[model samples]
Target: MWCLLPTPLCLISVFLLLQAPVAEVFLYVVYKQNSTCMDFRALSACFGPPVPREGLRGYLTEAAPANACQPIGSPPASSNSSEVFIALIRRSGCPFGVKVLHAQQAGYKAAIVHNVNAEQLVSMVADDKEIRQQIAIQSVFMGKSASKHLKRASRYEKGQFWSHLLKYSAYIVIPYVIQEFGFMINVVVCTITLVVCARWYKKGQKITVCTFKRGDKYDTCVICMAEYEDGDQLKILPCSHAWNTHTQILV
Candidate 1:
């Protein structure tokens, strides 16, 4: 009988364990609306929508698209026409200082960085506020695929792609799993403990009340002037008296 009892309990535990992860995943998917836009290319194109320009000054000199124009409010032309200007570089490879210096040297008006995966966008600033160049900087996460495309397009030759994999794994994936497991264990343990305690308390309980006798040197309840008896339910009043169901005095 004990073995059979454990089988059912184990089955229920397993069922609950399986259901916990599914429920957690469901809640996560429901809550995280941005994860759905993790495709880096899609996110980049959305954020970096082409701004139409009328003049050729803002267009890329190498392969300027016919429709592409300089963005509005660009700084005045630089003296060195031979310098190259680029925008929207990946943030992972390029440090903020280097990007600012590059922008100043190239006379670029702005620089935007997309995240490694391009899932979200952010702005970048130089740590040293003294170098106040007339350049703006921004960042975005390009999701894995979009980041790869940008990397390839930018001709990134050095640095292994997997260098940051361990960091991501440790920070994101492992911590999430550990938190979920801890929550599940706590729920199951608490539920089982509560059930066991409730059953133990209900095993041998009796409901009885105290009986009182008149003039038995007993303290009387101020409200009802009644005395308590053994095994009889007594209500203790604030005026140093115990009251029984029947309003009789026993001292």
Candidate 2:
């Protein structure tokens, strides 16, 4: 004779089986003090700390330290600050204040805001009323190309460049290509079906032919004040107005 195990005992055994490995691994790492697992000190050393810089005329007053770097949001020397600001407006969502605060929290000393269309450099004043110790603000005008290069360089240092590439390739680029190929195949099948349907419809349709005399006066189109010619197709808009191709005007 065989004995039946209780339901609760089976559940507890499964749960323990699943959780035991993870707990054992965690405790083993903890006891061994292994550097491979989630070490804040090691990760911080890899990225390094932010370099501190004084805000001077909307630019960094000094260079970054050997291990750290700062983001300089300014136009190139040859271009004016206004142009940089305009460019910033186009590429970056807003004037950069909101992102500046986030960057400050991440240890950025100053944000060099630039114009995309002008040459004069301007400084962004942080709202001192709400300023926190982590917040630092600065601005400058750098050309669009220079600004892009600076951003890329910064990402490269933080190991974000490759990570971003991997994310895009996995989620965006590959999926987009697959979707485009699928759409092309679907379009080809639809075209063939449409051709077959059109041929069948023509065989059963009763075609009508009409002739119009030249110089037959018709109502002039109000939009362009042009007389409709023969063989011209007319469309009656939803507003109860009729117009021909030559006389139709888009608002």
Candidate 3:
């Protein structure tokens, strides 16, 4: 038997069933030597909110229980107020969503769950509806190799500071330099245009009363040899030669 759902019920089903695609998240790790920074794109979980395009930054710390299948403790206290912590948990013991929920409960900004073995990265799917609904912060799955590299590099602070310092400085400086360069180019273009107009105005032909001295070359038309009369109009060439307005010089 064929049956049609009511409009309201259909709309509700669509809203509850559909899942929007999330953008990929790239994790940055600052190395121990000279703050050299390298980045790896992790697979986002089926659950949790999408990370903002600009992304989040924090120091990496291993989960208290290592697996994070149960409730974990809060992040370690730091004197620096701006310091935020992210939890690193190995993949095992429970579903991905449970691990993420534990990390979220412990006041971490985000969670990175890595593979237990050296396997290719896979998307972390929510095991149950209850856990998925409880998780809020962004959670991503990392490969074993990348996670090992991060664990080694997380011990250094000098490299992280300088790498992030340069990154922030570029965000502010690059736009300002581009704007100043554009303004200078516009000024140069306008100056050149004004100079060309001024030169054209000075060299252009003009109409004036015949008030020049009798012996002056401008007193007569150079092309027609016609003597100038009072109120006679004169056409001036760029070469400073004058002629009657009606006269036509072939060359």
**TM-scores of all predicted structures:** 0.28, 0.22, 0.52
- Candidate 2: residue 87 lDDT (0-100): 14
Q: Which of 2 and 3 is ahead in lDDT?
A: 3
Order candidates by TM-score, high to low.
Answer: 3, 1, 2
Local accuracy of candidate 3 as per-residue lDDT tens digits, 15-85: 01112445333333332224344555466677898654455556567787989999998877656566557
Candidate 1 lDDT over 3-27, as tens digits, reads 1111111000000011132232110
Index of the highest-lDDT prediction: 3
Specify the highest-TM-score model's number.
3
**Candidate lDDT values, in order:** 0.34, 0.31, 0.64
What value does the lDDT take at residue 127 in candidate 3?
A: 74
| Candidate 2 residue-wise lDDT, 28-130, digit = tens | 0000011111100000000112211210112111112211123434322423332111112222443334445444443333333433454333433334335
- Model 1, residue 225: C-alpha shift (Å): 19
Cα-based lDDT at residue 178, candidate 2 = 85
Give model 3's TM-score versus the native structure.
Answer: 0.52
